[model samples]
Target: MVVRRRAAPPERCRPSPYGLRPGWDWTARAADAFGRAWHLADRYPYRGTEFDSSFVGIFRVDAADLFSAAPDLVNPAWAEATGQQLQDMVPSYDFHRLEQLPQVLVEAARESGALPAVRDGQMRTARVCGLRAWLHGYRRDQAGSLIPVDAVRWDGGVHHALSVTDDSTDAELAAAARRAEQDAAARGIKLIGASRWVEQLRAARRTAVREQLAGLRDEIAALEDRLKPARKRRTVLVTRILGWDGERDTDTALGRDAGLSHTAVRTLRTALEADQEDRGGEEGGPLAGLFR
Candidate 1:
């Protein structure tokens, strides 16, 4: 009753309208245009990701489209030339393929003093326009590529939110300390001892805070450790339940679940079996074979 897993599918090529088409002499034209525009863009005093002629074939036509739409808005003579070169190279360019070009030209225009704004306004616009377009383009590409982007954006937003939340919490704690100090002073206790008294209060508060933080950190670590064993056990149990093909190796299952090397998993499984045998369980039971 062995279960055979399906084979992994072959990778698919990404669709590219500007890519090589049958019986088209577009490669040479694309190469030449890309090289010229890339060189011109390199000379411009723009700062950020260094895109060269290699990306010219990809973004050139779209940049040219932007120029056509708002010729006065983005007045970079090189950008216009680059766009024309791209058009000449790929006459039947896909509009979807040109998505990134508009953003690139916007950046170039900003760098060239074609787009003027205050620092704050510029940053906001860059985030909205540049970042948004980049994200959209990235998402449309594939799932795996999008995962890292999602992780980074999630981690960044969470980190920033935590910083603000922590600051507010600290402010509240400080205000509470101030009130406690005022109440102590109203009792006519020598204000000379105020500094020492405040110090003691803060030290006590900090000890409790440190203890609480330590407990939380320990809890998180423990949960992570527990998840390792649980995931390993789950993999083994699932394989057994599903009656999967190939030899069942608990060591391999544990290794995969815990992100450990196969050798480490084998070593761990050996150790586990030794411990189990010491307690006198049947040598060939479901659990016994698992450790073996």
Candidate 2:
């Protein structure tokens, strides 16, 4: 008898005022508002991760009412890489006119081949970037006839097909050659091809760093080896000084040997003596009467 484990089920999309809803997609909504955000952000810049997190807050109230529950719907991985930024320092999303979340989610889910046609999948990773790029290619007027992403519908399916460009059908190749010629004239760089120039620059930097660091590392290793015996000697001296019970000159002599300042040696000696006294140095404790 063979038993197989079942795949984990997808997240449910219940009706709520929050991050994700049926017809609303916060990621796209956030990206759409980004242009406006940048226009206003000319006055003040997004400090750090604030712009990313701000979109979530706006999405919660404006897009889906996500603040009520499961508020962190704008996954961090997507939000940070996403080019969207909030227009206001504080979010005041005005998406009520465009609000049709459940329907939008249903359509997105259908496009993505989700069973029962639920909500949109996480759209930030490169996995869905192709879909996003394709969607944005169409004008708003052309949205009605725009192709969706269903495998069954085979919409925008040519992208999935691998088309080799023979010399006869090499339009992109010809365009690239023209661009290269123009660029070579305008900028006296990349004459040997852009990719080759980039690789050469990278290789040169790596070689320089590796060659310099190899000698530096060897020098460091040699110095560390030389210091090993000295470290042992220092430890032994510190131990002996601690056992000196209450000797003052022993400390001075130890400092001279250790190449430490006399004041530092005196301080160490005082501490050891204090420690010995605390541990009954007057009664010939193991740590007492070393130099005395």
Candidate 3:
């Protein structure tokens, strides 16, 4: 057997653009060291760190702010480190929602004895908070990157807002959303608790119901087509029988076996004869046109 040795990745010692303290350079170093492994490995193992076991969340920095504030430092290498380093190094931090961010940061700061800071000259705090709310639990995968968690599909807010089963159909979801809406309205509460989730549920239900109704309409048409021959034969027979007895009221026996009322049987026979005449001539029997 022949064995081929794998070559190690080229070493990178690029200076931090974020003006990092000595150990904090781990971000860039991690990108340099672990980027290939994360990209290439189907299942990359998490490297246990003091942060991982303690539930310590990484202090997230805005890539946009980094780009705007220090445009000169926004090279491809820096971008790669900024985007992938923390995500690869600390999966626990990436697993949380934005609503949990304040608490996560607070806990991390308390444990680490270092508080997260925003530069005074950066965008106003209100803008930051609003933007964060708009982007809560949002992550998108870039081309050639690892498959990302579909944030909307796995939204915690939806799970907490309403109870749903795995097998819940669109109609069931719609009904559940409507019930939830009514409950909220009764309590004078806003149904915006789940961020347009109710609307989405309703839309899904409408689409499903429309599809089901369309399918049923097709089935009904096919059944009517199959019943046409039988209906024509019944009409011809009814005409012959009615000829034998001119008293239509005495023909209770006509519909008794079919579980229909005498009046219903008469109505059906009349309609069938009319339909046959509309198609052209009644070709069934000699008495076919006599009752009309």
Top-TM-score structure, candidate number: 3
The per-model lDDT (C-alpha) reads: 0.41, 0.39, 0.43
* Candidate 2 deviant stretches above 4 angstroms: 1-183, 186-190, 247-292
State the lDDT of candidate 1 residue by residue for 1-292, as single tens digits: 3333344335243222334333322222353455556456544443333421223222222333353554463423222122123334333322332233456656675676544444355322211112222223333332232222221122223322222222245555445434543443344321122223334444666677789999999999999998987777754654353233335545566457657677865655555455445756555534455544
Off by over 4 Å in 3: 1-151, 155-193, 246-249, 258-260, 267-292
Residue pairs with colliding backbones in model 3 are none
Q: Comparing 1 and 2 by TM-score, which wins?
A: 2
Report the candidate with higher TM-score, 1 versus 3.
Answer: 3
lDDT of 1 at 252: 65
State residue 283's C-alpha deviation in candidate 3, in Å. 11
Error of 3 at 140 (Å): 14
lDDT of 2 by residue, 1-292 (tens): 3333344334462222233333433444453355346434432343343342232212212223222233343333222121122212112332332133334543454476431211463332111111222222321123233321222122222332222122223454344434543444343321223233233334555677788899999999999999987876664576575565545546566677688777776665666667566774456544344434
Residue-by-residue lDDT tens digits, candidate 3, 102-212: 444435544774333445522211111111211221222221233232223433335433555444666666666566555544544333322245445555656888899
Off by over 4 Å in 1: 1-190, 214-229, 235-258, 261-263, 268-292
Candidate order (TM-score): 3, 2, 1
The TM-score obtained by model 3 is: 0.33
